[model samples]
Target: MPAASALVDLENLRHDVDDALDRHLTRLRDEVAATGPGTTALTDQVSTLLAGGKRLRAAFCYWSFRAHGGASSGAARDAVVRIGAALELFQAAALLHDDVMDASDTRRGRPTAHRVFEARHRERQWSGDADRFGTAAAILLGDLCLVACHREAGAALDALPTDVGRAARDMLDAMTSEVVVGQYLDVLVQAEAWGLDPTADEDRARLVLRAKSARYSVERPLTLGAVLAGASPDRVAAISAAGLPLGEAFQLRDDLLGVFGDPEVTGKPAGDDLREGKRTVLVARTLAAGDDDARLLVTKHLGDARLTDDDVAALRAAITGSGAVAGVEALIDELAAQGLSALATADLDAHGREVLTGLAHAAVDRAA
Candidate 1:
């Protein structure tokens, strides 16, 4: 296929995934409504949250299946789309829980789910602490999304060969386990930063990146697709090798954006990561390379929830002056090059190669 047509095909696949999610969510909402009107709010919240992402996970899964000689049409292609939708639903659950954990105020340019629920409580004049109510509701909603994820993925897997189904399910299970563990580590890192030794900062940050973001965001999704396509172990390994570095680069870029990206582009407040005291790779690098003054600046303001605009500006200056941003950019370039090289050498179809290459660039080089 021509490059333009290949790009069009990928876009169409993304739309199909969206349509699948819509249909699934509609069915869920209707089912819940039959149980109780109040219970349907969970589905409503998830549907709204799932509507706005770039769907990068789905694209990676779709193209990876194509790369592994999966059928392009009929029930096989539709099953892949369903799997993609399942990934999206799982992601939504993660994001909802993550926002609550981070005390995040916004997501995809809208109020976070917990905050939305809190506002709803206030609006209704409910008889409880609005914040607590919101947090509880968001947590339940996240759990509901997880159940939905399993249901969606199970149905898709049922259509695959037994071995492929087993492998895909295993990948999904691993992805979820890694993300949850990563999130716990993230919480621990922040809570223990003061007591922990500074020397392990970079290592800890990389560990969190791999677990919380990298594998689920790219590597596992690609491998899951390959598995569903009945690719050999060697093929899955090669795709994962390519995907891991790309996934790392993707999270590194996200770390950069979390600290320095424009709120308009990133759909979050500027300096939100700093406010939350996220021990990102950039911050670790800055701490390692910065002078005493820079270290003092970070110590004073890194986790200050009441940070003023001036404080944020000063912290930004300290981070920039430490050259950590430059270091991360260099790392991103290096990792991206490694990933592209792997893709170039991998035994994939010409169109799959082209789309995966584009996805690699999109993952690491986007503003959001």
Candidate 2:
């Protein structure tokens, strides 16, 4: 028997997910190849977007399947991994479009796809304005990603049982639609003319976080995996119970990183979220505290590209002083605790439970 180690065996599972993504991408690229010559940029953008990430959603999907008695033999696990890969592709699509919508220049520590293409166009002295070139390229790239996600998902379920295929399709549909709606809400909130109640603003942000980020990150993937594996509704519910809180904690940590993490580590500039005026739950809560000076500081400094270091320092102090930092930290702890408790009592297999517990710790405890 293999000796037990302190770490979970999720590495092997990660490889499986990677392999599934590779296969699906290969077929997708082939389809793109059949297109006209000038469309090569489209194919390259698709590959670039797929090239990197932590693959958190894929991990969740695989674990959910294993938790629900999914056999690892042959293609059973691979099928679930493929579904997870499709989720990642969907995310890439959302992000590509999101960068364009947000006018973001950077992503994952590099020029966003549109920015890269736009820069290329300028260097080559292309006919159109660089800004328009970037926007057009990003929009097309995002659309291609969306199409690939559906094609990959359909191919994954093509050989599965009818019931399983139906469940997977339903999850894909809901995830796609909800994420788009959440993105719209995020964009509208940035405009800050919604006339929403002050008290409800943070709650609304939380709702968007849950639906847009958290569900796609963990909850929906887990539920979809269990459904595909024919797990009981009760079992599926338990997996969601374990996934949702943990996922939220993950995003809470992300919110903190967006404001404070090192650029070297987070692949984003310091205070990028503030510079973008992202209406994160943390910022919303800080505003809710209604501190007069803090409000003024945020209104003036937040989202300003030309903000000085002193301004960032002041804003950080305001956030910390307003108790929003500590409040969010408390919420992270609570959510992590609740997720672990659910794992302990969940009906999942012992290995699944243990792996998930370790993942929860890593998700919430990491610096980045």
Candidate 3:
């Protein structure tokens, strides 16, 4: 764990990032207000979603910049904060679309955007199908968020040196493209799970984890910060190496939480991933390693949209009894170790090293 001061510093950074996001969104709202009342809901929905998040990406970006000897005051610090805000907006866009794609009902313990819109339609006795209307609205809101993300990043990067700005922009572009492709792969895997090569399930899941979650959530943010700071190539590589494994472990922990964590702690329903039939590494391992009866149990209920509580309980048992839970725990430990080891060799200040180590611990050893 980091010293109290380090933890406080991280918290302060989170507050700064939040303030930046609020200011950016307010400006956006003012600009869009001139268009019409129709867009207000979109901005409101985005604002609501952005209101609550771990802000891990922003923390990683800020600390990475500091680790590479970037200035921590004046315009430099403010520019980094704006870049962090951009990352938050990107995350908002991803979540908005992800909830719709997963047909999820809730997020952060509230009705998902689509579900909220659906209820609004039903209450108003709108003339069309409520579900469709909700989906359309959510999609448009997601698109708007994506545009905002790019715009925010562009503005922040404009304040940097030309080479640094171009590097950050390129990385951001790649990050966005990777996430979209990874998301498509996720949808494809879910659809093809029944016929997917069982031998390749783990590999495929890992690829999706790296692309969809790890890089976007950790590596790219760190790399972007390093780039912005004009870090040496070797130094940038070291940070990325550290971040990638930590990021994967972060997602792996999330996979376990999705099935087994307390809903109150995770801010999501238990077994929601099972309901969505997520072809996660844990699920793939269970399918590959479980006995015949266990396999049958998982196959029968894994993707059932109308899964009852009992069904979820049974599936949970099947997954656990098959030893897949322990397997995933082991993997998380290994990845966390790998990530921490990389950090040991990283050319960073004492504070940077401690904070990154603390973040790795927080990323993996969490209930949510």
Q: For every model shown, what is its TM-score relative to the native structure?
A: 0.96, 0.93, 0.96
Q: Per-residue alpha-carbon lDDT of model 2 for 1-368, expressed as tens digits?
A: 12122232354765666677777777766777787666677777777767766776776777778878888765666678778778888889988998888677788788898898899899999896999998998998898889888887898888788888988898889988888888887877777642146568778778878877887877788788788778988988988898899889988898998888887887777887877777887887788784889877876777787766677778899998888899999999999999889889988888876766766776787666
Better of 1 and 2 by lDDT: 1
**Cα deviation in Å at residue 113, candidate 1?**
0.3
Sort order, TM-score high to low: 3, 1, 2
Ranking by lDDT: 1, 3, 2
* Tens-digit lDDT string for candidate 1 (1-368): 23422452564887798888998899999898999768877787887899787788888998999988987897778888999999999899899999999999999889999999999999999997999999999998888888888899999889877887888888899888999998898888887755144558888888889999999998988888888888899999999999999999999999999889999999999998899888888888888888889888998788787888788888998999999999999999999999899989988888788888888888888788
- Candidate 1 colliding pairs: none
Off by over 4 Å in 3: 2-11, 193-196
Candidate 1 local Cα displacement, residue 3, angstroms: 12
List where candidate 1 sits over 4 angstroms from the true fold.
1-11, 194-198
The Cα error of candidate 1 at residue 176, in Å, is 1.1
Of the candidates numbered 1 and 3, which has the greater lDDT value?
1
What would you estimate as the lDDT of candidate 3? 0.86
lDDT tens digits, residue span 137-199, model 3: 998888888999899888888887888888888899999999999999888888774524666
* Model 3 residue-pair collision total: 0
* Candidate 2 wrong stretches, greater than 4 Å: 1-11, 194-197
